[model samples]
Each structure stands twice: as structure tokens, then as C-alpha cells.
Target: MEVGEMEMRMSTLSGEQGKEKETQSDEDRGYDENMSDSPRESVDSTNETPSKKTQLEDGSHSLSVIKKAVVVLTRLPEYKVSTLRPPTPQQFYSEDESHSSSDSDMQWEPEDNSSDSDFSVTDSKQKTGKPTQNDTKKTPAPQTMSEPAPIIISSAFAYCANEITKVRPDLPEEEVKVGMMVLARKRHMRWQQGKIVEIITRKDGRLKYKVNFVEKGKSLVSGHHIAFDNTPKLEQLYVGARVVVKCQDDKFQSAILAELPTRKNRLRFLVFLDNHVPVYVGLPLLHLVCRPLENSLDDIRDSPHKCFMSRYLRDWPYPHLTQYSAGQSLNAELNGVQQRCEVQEVDSSLIHVVFQDNQHKEWIHRGSIRLEHMTRFLELKEIEDYLDDSD
Candidate 1:
């Protein structure tokens, strides 16, 4: 029993001892927890002041970056700006402007004269760039030709009488007088147109004149003459009178009389043909014609036959006879008998005749058949027809 009791006591003591140890361990755990809570409290306190310390560190870092940027900017050199600016009004006046400015700006003035006001506007406009009325005028173009008028002879001399001188085929009946002036075709420098001093006809049946003042200190002479036979009529002209004359050598043109001749004379010549035959006698050509054997001056005297012969001789134009009536009558009378004569020769004096019969032809001296016989022969029809056929 004793041994069992000892064992039970020892177990109770152990149980009590474990309870005390457990209590002491609980106290020690509480102390260690308190000690651990103090460290956490200290951690919370440090956490509360950490924001201030963090702000101070951030400020120091920002200050350091600003100081670095300031140092970088301060190390660079200063920059210059290159720019252009307009000049002011003061600079414009500073330049030399004598040619651009007026004298009024310098207080200069003209004298107060009336003419000054007239030119003032003109001068002002000229200085201010404007044209005046006179400045706009233009010069005219020049002319290129120069000539004079012509003088006709008729208009120059009008005192001369008009009369027919020498007529032409194409021109009108021209006038002739002592002082008539005419243009000369052959001698242009001679006194073709001049004062007539004297009129004379030559032995060869030509009229000439003594002309005066044709050239320098001298006179001119020409072979040309007037035809008295062809003059218009007695009433148309007279001697010692002023008249317009035509130069025969010219193509028959007329002009006024420049002067008159002091003398005039009739020209004389022997009749070359039979007196019984009428001949055309012009002082210019002195033409003559013989009448046929069968006709007489009585047959042709009052006849235009004289005029016809005159025109024929002077190379003028006139009407022709329809037939040779005298020749025809003579030829009819000797037709069958066959004793007819043919004219063989004709000259200024005589006409030789030859008769041709049935047997043979023979020559006969018909001695200048009287102008009356020639007239009859020319008038015969058969003779005229035979002459025409033979010609």
C-alpha cells in the first residue's frame, strides 16, 4: 500500500507542477506579445512621418533637376535676330531731294508781275509732271511738188484780124494777116511768129515775107508762103492790116498777130496754058490745067471745074465729075470710021497726038491743041471711058 500511495502522490505533484509551468508560460507569451505590439506601434509611428520625409526628398530631387536645367541653359551663348524694317519719313527727307522738291519749300518766290500769274500754273504743272497746251502741238508734214502754168499764143495777142491762110486736111480754116504770129515746125528758133515788114512773091511763083525781131538782135527767114488763090474771099482779109497768120511749113495751125507789115505787092506771071482754058493759079503751087479739045473757057468759066482743078493742083480735096461728057460725044462721032487720035505727049506748052486707024497708026503734030479743044476732048464720054480703061 505504501508504495502505491507514493506513486499517487508523486503524480499529483507532477500535475500541480505542470499547471504552474503552464501558467508561467502564459505570462511569458503575454509579455512577448506586448513586446511584438511595441515594434508594430513603432512601425506605425515611422509610417506617419514618412510622407514629410518623402516630400522633402522629392523637393530636393526637383531642385536638383531645375539646377541642372539652369546650368545647361546658362552655358549656351546669346542668339541674335536678323530682320528688315521700313525707313521712316525722317530718313526719306535725309536723302538728297533737290531735283524732286520745289523751290517753294525753300521760301523762294517770283516777283509779283501780271505775267507771273499766267505762267505760274504752267510752271507749276510742269514741275508737278503734267503737259501744257503748247507742248502737245505737232509739226505738219512737208509738200513735195512745184510747177507753173502754160501760156497760149491766142491769149497773148488778140488785136489781129482773123482770115483763112493755108487750110489743112485735118485742121480748120486758119487766119492770116501782116502781123500774125505762127509757130514754125521746121525753124523753132526763128521769127516764125513775128511782125511782118513786107510781103513779096518770087519769080518761081512763091510768096515770102520780111519778118522782124525773131531772134536776138536779128530776124528769121523761111521758104514757106501763103496761097492767095485759096484765100477764103476778098471780104475776109485786106492788106496793111493786123491779123492772125499760119506758117505754111507748120501742119496749118493759127495764132494771134504779133505785128503788121508796112508794104504789100501783087505778084505777076505769064499764063502757061491757052488763055481760052481756065487754069487754077495758087501763089503757093501755081497750078495750071488745059481744057480738052472739045470744050472752051465759056464751058468752064462759071463752072466749079475751076475749083476742082485748083484743089487737084494744090493737093486739096474736092468733088469729082460724074462722067466725061465731052470725051464721050467726040468718041461716038468717030466710032465706026476708025480715024481716032490718042494723046501721046503733054507738057507745060503742047500736047502731041497720034491717030490709030483700021490700016495703021501714025503720028501727027496737033500743035498745042487749043485750050478749047482740050476742054471738048475732056468732056467727051468715049474719050473719058477709054482713058479710064487704059489707066
Candidate 2:
């Protein structure tokens, strides 16, 4: 019995050992499968993590590049960037385009309230701001143009009219018609014969006449300077008188009146010079030298008239005849024509003169020259035209 019991115990022990070995093999197989699966899972997890990290880095780099592009666009000028940019809301749009945009905005309003509110505020601010800026730019231009234009125009007209009046105070204001002959005082204060060309009436109702002066150019003259006739009227005063008459050469010569003036002869007197040269003269040309008694005409005719004239001529108050000097400027008679001359040499009764008009030189009697005071007066009057502006 003991031997059988020992065998059985030994078999049971062996069986227990075999079962334990089987359990170990199963556990080992499971562990080996787990190890293989774990390796594949770990590989997949590592790949996925690295891929996610790379994707995030690529997204961040693209964002940085896009930001740099926006910065570069912002730094460019408006005109250069205009082609690259879309139309802005504040820019001017056609009526149809604005209506369409408004409809689209209305359609999108409920879906995008915050964006719509911001856009509306910006549009309102832009609309209000633009007009004020335009007003500031436009207001000054009209004011600058309108304020001083009339004042300057009126002042200029007044100044010109005043200057004309001051220069020709001797002129008589007369009603004149176009195509009429009149004596007009020139700007140089010289009387000239002119025919009225046109009559200009200003907006202020003032009249200015255009004159075509004889031998001079045309000029605009005021009414004050126009005279239909400027000749002095001759009357029956002192016939048969000895007189000094300004001849055609502008020299004063002694003459004895032979006949009184008559309307048929245009108020001219018949006179005989000391050389017995007969001529007709206007009243203005004659200065009374001496009016002899009515009964002395026969005695004066019988006596030598040349000798009587020479006696009076010697006592004539002509101071400039003795005051001749070299380089003196005077008006003289050359070949019976009045001319401007400069004295080259002087003698007691004769002077060497160089004509200003033709540079011709000649010796002439001192009696042929005009008075010095008349030339000086004319020069001073011309100078007064410029000096009046200072006052």
C-alpha cells in the first residue's frame, strides 16, 4: 500500500508540474503577441505626433508670410496700390451700383449685424466729413475773386480820368458829334487838329471820344478837350495900325494894317510887312505895336516905311535876341519852314544853327529864332504830366 501511494503522489506531482508549464506557455505567447502589437502602435503614435507638429508649424509659417505681404501692401502709395486693391465702401459709385450694393447689404444685415453696424458708422462719418472738407476748400476762392475786383476797376478808371482833367484844364467842355473837326489838346499839352472818329459811352454814363489827329496817331480824348473852333474872333478895333504879326515861319515880323477884318475873308486882316510883302493874317497872330492917329496915314505912306519899321524893331522888347549862346536850343525859320535847331556859334545878329530834324547847318538872323521862355514853358508842361502822379 505504501508503494502504490508513493507512485500516485509522484504522478500527481508531475501532472501539477505539466499544468504549470502549460500556463507559462500561454502567458509567454500572449506576452509575445503584446510585444509585437505594442511596437506597431508606438510607431503609429510617433508618426502621428510628428505629422501634427509639422502641420502646425507649416500653418504658422504661412500666416507669417501672409502678414508680411499685408504690411508691404500698406506701405505702398495709393495710386500704385489702387490696381491691386478692391473698391472701398467710401469711394464714389454710380447710382445703379450704389442701389445694388444697398440691396445686398440689406440682404446680409441680419446675418452680420456687427459688421453692418461698423460699416454704417464708417459710411456716415465719411459722408459728413467730406462735405466739410470740400466747403473749406471751396469757400475762399469765390470770396477772393469777388471782393476786390470792382473796387480795383473803379479806382483805375477814376485815376485815369483825374489825370486827364489835370493835364488839360484850359480845354472847354463842348458837345461834339462824330466826323466833326475840332481842336483837341494832346497829352503833351499841344493843340492839334483832329477829326472825331468814335464816341464811346462808359457804363457810368461818361463819354470819351476817339480822335484821328492830323499827322499824329489816333488818341482817346475827353469832352473837355474838344472844341469845334479855337480861332480868336477879329473885330473892327484900330485899323491902319502898326502891329507885330506871327508869320508862317513862327517868327514875329512888323506889319502895317491895310484893311480891317471881314466875314467874307474869314475874319483875316490885310497887312503889309516892312519889305512891302502883302499877306492876310488872323487876329490871334497880330500884337499891337502902335496905332497911329487917323490923319497920319498919308504921312506914314509918304515916308520910307522900311526906315520907320526898322526904328520900331530896334526898340522892340526882344531880350532873347541878345542872349544867344553856343549850344542853345531854339525854334528857327529855315527855308521859310519852322524847325528845331541847336546853336553852334553866336554873333551879334547872326547865329550858326544845326537843324534837329535833318542835321542841316546854316547861319541865320537872330530875329528868326523864337523866344527862349516859350520853349522852356512847353518843356515844363510836359514834365508836369509825370510829376502830377506823385501828388
Candidate 3:
């Protein structure tokens, strides 16, 4: 009877264990049916929590890096920070850098914003792949053509005309008149005595004198090229007379009359210049030096004539010797017109100048050059003073 009861108990326990296993299997099947019904939701639900945690960790890492960069920037100087940053429009397009982009076709727009503007410009450039007017580079404007200043014809002849008129007041009206006996220079010939028969007026209203010479016949001459026929007496210019004569160096030197004028030499006197041999010079080239007291030739020679001659030669009266130098620009007379020239070489009394217009080179007397800047300055100052007076 006891053995039968034990078997019944064992059967009951086994039946209970089977019922629990069936219940666990039914729960697993229901779970699989829910996963199949919304597979994406199940997968997302499983991944969502871990992804959130990972994102939080990544955000913390980025924040730490940004904070570190901010701290480093804060420790740096303002100028250093600015150097690290991109340049502003004004800073980029400065005068010193303007020439760098002069040939570039890109245009630039000025921005008042901070670094954000730079990013926006970069984004725009990347999107369009072309430079716009609002870009960083710019094309400079086309320069305007300016009308040149008027060409001033400042000639040496003009200066001489004014100086000669000041020295001889009668030259302008009395000597240049018609029916005057004057010395006129002929073409390719020496100056000859002539009588002004008629005054001819040109189409340009310039007065020209028609002179009849004894040997050269009739010829037209300019008034300035003619001189009054007031010939000095050759007898009065005695030996040892102090005179000034133009030497081979184109400079007027103090000379002593070694011999009196003779008709055989065409009334030219034999004169001795300082440090030079005796030379025959005509009356036109000889200027006599007058003394207060009359002295004989022997007395004049015994006096301090050498000392006077040395001093006169050393310090010449002409201003051009000291004023002009090589590479200096001035206006000089070429032919009959005034043109711009550069001094190629300067000698004692002559200047070798090259014409700027035609590159023609010629040796000109130092007196023939006129400084354009000086004349222009004088004119401008005079005009300004006149305007001030009028006001």
C-alpha cells in the first residue's frame, strides 16, 4: 500500500514541472509575435538608450575641446587673436596690398560683420564656384586720362632780348627804325654795315627791316640781329688797353691789347688772354674796360693787371656756369624755336644738350638754357599775388 502512494506523489510532481515548461514556451512565442509585428520599433527601442548615452559622452567631449580652445584664445593677446582670424575688408584692401590684386578680375565687398561674414562668403564662393562683386578680390577702376600742361617755350633769345632792352633803351625804337645805318648779320657771312631802306611787316605781324649793304646787296634782317653802326675809333683803343674777348672755350676772358687794330687784319686787334697765346679778335668780340684815370700803355702794364685778369676769369659774370649740370632739364633754343633739352655735359661756358623731342644733340652756350620750373614758379606766384590783391 505505501509503495503505491509514493508513485502517485512522483507523478504529481512531474505533471507540475511540465505545466511550468509549457507556460515559459507560451510566453516566448508571444514575445516573438510582438517583435515580428513591429520589428523597427523593437530594434529602435533596443538601440535608443545606448545611443543617447554615447551622444551625451560625445557632446561632453566636444564641449571640453571648445572650452580648452576658448581658454587658450583668452590667454593670447588681442593682436595675436586678430592675426589668427581672417583679415577685415579694410585691412585686406590696404594701399600696400592694392597693387597685388591690380590685375585680378575678382571683385570685393566690404563687410562690417565679424568672422561670420567670412564663413558666409566662403560658403557662397563654394556654392557658386565663381567670384562675385561681393567677393574678397576687386578690380581697380579705370584711370582717367588727364590733359597735359601746355608746352612752354622758354628760350635763351627771349632772355637776351629782355636784358639787351634793359641795357640799351634806345635799341627798341630808335636803332631799329627805317632809314637807319646799322650793322646787319647776313646769311653765312660776317656782320656788314647796311642802311635800313624799308620796314617790312610779315603775315605774323613781325617787323623785318630791308637793309641794303655796300657789298652784300639787299637783304631782310630781324631787328635784334642788327646793331647801331656807332663804330669805336681804332686809334682810341691803344696798346695795353684792358679788354674782354670770347676765347676758344666760349668764355669771355679779360685780355690785354698786345697790338693796335690794323686795316690789314680787318680792324681786329691782337690781344693776349690769361694763360693763352695771343689771338686776333674783331671789334664785335672785344669789349674795352674803362678806367677812371688815363694812363699810358707802360703804366697800365706795370699796374696790377695780372691780378685783375685772374680774378675776372675765376669768377665769371655769367650765372650759367654754376647753375647748370649734367642731367639737368631746361629749355634751349634750337634753330629759331624753343624746345626741351637735357644737359648731357657741362663745360666751362658751353653745355652739350640733347633735345627731348627729336633726340638731337648739340653744344649750346650756357646762356641759352632757361629753367622751366623757375619760370613757371614765378608766373604762378605772380598770379597768386595778383589774385590776392584783387580780392
Candidate 4:
């Protein structure tokens, strides 16, 4: 319901930053801690070694030695039992090469050692001071995201009342997430009213939407493309109509269909001030009314942006007047009297006209000059009558 200023621009959310925010909100607290506890404990227990076990190169160890190690490890404080030893760079590279070589062999083998024996071997392995290879491979930190792209828009005039609205400025793009109501103009079509269902990216690098709206229990619209306009103010938008879309000065050029993706759809229209900078527009009437002398109502209604444009160009009961050109030479005729005038000047109002009657005389006001009488009466007026009266 808020009206946008003429300078507003529409933008949208996209890319990794947007995805991350959505993911963070869906994550459950405590879930990570609960899942990691058991795994941490198992890893710690396996790393424990007994002092009695003699470490060997063949990877074998005695059962009694492992049992003694477990008992001793259990008696120790939890903090002392496990030491976090991260691998050195040289050892990490060596292990990585070894694993890579072994993986290519594609042969699976079962261990002949008992669980107790394996535990002692692991303990002895820990005593040797070698660390896990994973400790060396650090994950790269996440990078900061860049800003979203700006919305592009164009301008056109309204052709009809179906696109008109009293709503004024439309909403902002920040407020227009997926699932908000919007107004759009279809390419080569009338302005349509609809709500957004999803925002999607196209192969052509423009962001578009899957919109949903109903007309009399039937779906009126679905996935549609949108473009921008420069005429309407940012906040006010044409609501509930489809429009023919025009991109360049040539109407023959191809263009995408468009609507407000959300209530916040802001666009730029081309304003011929100095250079072509972006200007915002809302509703069709405001565009026409603001520069009525330069723009016409029919031109707007028929424009590609008309669905939204039409919404502003509402019909009125009264007829408006505009000046029309008249040819040179005022043939003077005054109230059934005719005469030739040497020089003339004239002034006109809605109800009357005043002009010099010729003979280098002063001007006179003609009462109630009707459209039908203008030409005929001009043929029969006297300039001398005004001059004689003045004398």
C-alpha cells in the first residue's frame, strides 16, 4: 500500500548467502553434540596403550598386554587418557601417498588379530607418537558473499481501465520474498494479478518466477518472466493485469513477460531529462498525468507496460480540452457584420473570446463563441466599428 518514489530500483535475493541463511534456520540445536559423543569416546578408547605391550613392526601384540592397558587407561582421568596429537606435514603427505596407492589395488582383506590384540596395537601405535592424517587437512574457511544484482526496468503507457489501481506505490523487493502477491504484465498480453510461488534463475541470467493466482476458481497464471519500467514510481505498481512488453524503442523487438515478483517489485523507466538514468513509476495514470502534454492516455494503455500503466490511467466523467493549431489570417466578422482588418490580435477563454476588430482599433470580447460558429462568424466582422466607437 505504500507509494514508492520515482527513483526506486527493484532488487532480489539469490546465490550461496541466501542458501546458507535458509540452511542455518533449519538446523536443530544439540543434534551435532548428541551424534559426536559416542564416536569421540570410541576413538579415545582405541587410542589408549598399555606400558607392558612391546610394540612390533608386523602389527601383532599380546592379549594380556592390551587388557592391562585398558585397565590402566580406565583408572586415569579422562583428560589425561586422550592426547590430541595432530600429524606433522611430512607424516601427513606420506600417509596420503600410501593410502592413495593402496586404494588403487581394490582388494579387501580381513584382519586376523583379536579385538584385544588390535587395541594393544593401536595403543603401541599411539605410543609411537604418530597422529591421524585428517588432523593435517584443514578445511578452508567460508568466504563472504557478494551483493545481489539490480532490477532492470522499462516504461510504457496504459491503454485501458483493467490495469488501473488506487493502491499507489508498490512494496519493496526486500519485503517481497517468495509467496507474496504481485501485479504483472505479460508480454503481448494484458496486465494480470497474481501471487508469487517461487523465484528462479534463467539460463539467460535473469531471475524469473513461478507465480500462482486464480480467476473464478481457475488458475489465472503460473510461471512467468518479468521486466522493469522506468516511468512508475518505485512503490506504486500496476496491479492485476497482463501487458505487452517492449524492450527497445522499436516495439518489434522481443521482450519477456513481467509482473511484480512480490509487492516490492521496483523498476526504472526511461526519463528524457539529461541522460537516461533510471526513474521509477507506479500505476499508469501517474505516468500520463505527470507529463500529459508529452504523453497520451492511449499510448500508455497500448504499451507493453500497460497492465500496470492502465491501473493508474483511470477514466473520468468529464472531457479534457487541448489546444489545436489554427491557420494564419483572421478574417473578421462581428455579429452578422463583415469587414477587413489590417492587423489583429486575439485572446480566448472557455466561454468567450476577445480580439482586435481591425482599423488599428482596440479589442472586443465576443460572447459565447461556439465551435460551430467560429469559421462562419470570422467571415463577417468589422474593424471600423470598434475604431469609430473608440473615437
User: TM-score for every candidate vs. truth?
Assistant: 0.15, 0.20, 0.25, 0.18
| lDDT tens digits by residue: candidate 4, 1-391 | 2224311311121343355445644443333434532213333345443333333233463323443223111233456545544556776467544443211111111122112111111111122232336532332222431221111111222223423232333354334347565544433333344566676677886555655643422132323323222234434433322222332342211121122322222332212111111122223422211111122223332332333233223311111111222222332345445443322433321112233454344332121122212222221222323554789
User: Where does candidate 2 have its weakest 10-residue lDDT segment?
Assistant: 149-158
Best by lDDT: 3
**Least accurate stretch of 10 residues (summed lDDT) in model 3?**
65-74
**Higher-TM-score candidate of 2 and 4:** 2
Which of the predicted structures, 2 or 4, would earn the higher lDDT when compared with the native? 2
Candidate 3: residue 128 Cα off by (Å)? 69
Model 4, poorest ten-residue lDDT window?
101-110
Residue 39, candidate 3: alpha-carbon lDDT: 15
What C-alpha lDDT does candidate 3 achieve relative to the native structure?
0.46
For candidate 1, lDDT tens digit of each residue in 1-391?
9779857866775676577658756755764555522112112222121111111132344211111111111112223111234556876543333234322211112122122221111222224432233432321122431211110001111122432122211323444456644332223212233455665678987556555544433243332322222333333322211121323354232111111111110221112121122121223322111111122222233233343334222321111111121112111113224244544543222233344454232222111122223223233423545766999
List the global CA lDDT of all models. 0.29, 0.45, 0.46, 0.30
Residue range 102-161, candidate 3, lDDT tens digits: 221212221211222221111112233334444434423324413222122211211222
The residue-by-residue lDDT of candidate 2 on 1-391, one tens digit each, is: 9779857866775676577658756755764655522112112222111101111132344211111111111134456556666777757654333432211101100112122221111122123212333333332333223221100000011122221121112333244688877656465324456788999999998788888988688888766445443333333234445455667775455556544543323455656565445567777776542222333233233244444333323322211122357886766655556677888986433467799999998665343323232223223333554576677
- Candidate 1, TM-score vs. the true structure? 0.15
